[model samples]
Target: MNIDEDTSAWLGCPTPLEMYKHQCAMLEDELTTAYQLLKKARANIAGLVQMNDLLATEKAAAESQLRSVSADLSRVHVQGSEMSKQIMSLKIIASQNEHLHIENQRLLLELSVLRGPRS
Candidate 1:
């Protein structure tokens, strides 16, 4: 209430109202800094999500291509087996024909011997 009392109060310590105002200003600055950090963190999370989606798409495409290549290899194996079986069948037929020709030649020689000195 007196000038001397006011001067003594200011010199010794701050009033309660003045301390409260200072604390409020400090808290406002801290809140602004926290908000800026949170915004940057959210942007980083969004970029990571997009990168994960792209990797998943590439993985699916690679799996599909692998399956297609496996199917083609299986088809080639089946065709090769069929060709081997045909080749074996042809070999058996050729052996049987050679035996028949040899038998025919022996029979013709016997017939000429039985006829004796033919004119």
Candidate 2:
């Protein structure tokens, strides 16, 4: 149909040209909002990546420190075990010394008895 007949058919309706322009403006506004959202999302993603990298570095350092501490604890345990062995040895030697001293005292008494009464 002719433009006038089509226009006349829809009484009080917006012209096709006006409707298209309105839809285009709405679409442009939506696109602008979407672009802004995308920029914000990208910035957030970048910040998250940097934080993740920092956390990973910190975790590695903590693990290294833990390993060092574990090694130190193992060394301390070994030293403690050695010290315990040495203490046991010392105890045994002290017991032997006590036994020898008693035996020597008994022998001295026997020697005096064998000599009889002194003038």
Candidate 3:
């Protein structure tokens, strides 16, 4: 019958201020949820950074140990080659000594035959 009642009846009885309050409350809830998600993401990022640092340190140590072992292996290989050369040299010397002893024994037999009448 009146203008206010007619407007309220047509607009379902909710005013502009009540609608604003309801929208504000929904925005606050969304903001709170967003803040919580941001905090968890930050914590996860920090943990990942710490893990990356630890892995880097371990990788450096492993590389260092690999280099050291490679150097030692190279030194052992050189020593083995030198030992093989020494063994060959000793074998040649022993063969020469055996040949010389045989020649001395033949020469001594010839001397004894030439001095046949010796008492």
**Model 3 — which ten-residue stretch has the worst lDDT?**
2-11
Tell me which of candidates 1 and 2 scores higher on TM-score: 2
**Predicted candidate 1 versus true structure: per-residue lDDT over 1-114, tens digit per residue:** 555554646567878898999999999999999999999999999999999999999999999999999999999999999998998998898888888888889998898899
What's model 3's overall lDDT? 0.93
- lDDT by residue (tens digit), candidate 3, 10-80: 65867889899999999999999999999999999999999999999999999999999999999999999
User: Which regions of candidate 2 deviate over 4 angstroms?
Assistant: 1-11, 88-119
The TM-scores of all predictions, comma-separated, are: 0.52, 0.63, 0.59
**Which of the predicted structures, 1 or 2, would earn the higher lDDT when compared with the native?**
2
Deviation in angstroms for 117 in model 1? 30
| Residue pairs whose backbone atoms clash in candidate 3 | none
Which ten contiguous residues of candidate 1 have the minimum total lDDT?
1-10
lDDT tens digits, residue span 10-70, model 2: 6877778989999999999999999999999999999999999999999999999999999
Scored against the true structure, residue 70 in model 1 reaches a CA lDDT of 91
User: How many clashing pairs does model 3 include?
Assistant: 0
Of 1 and 3, which scores higher on lDDT? 3
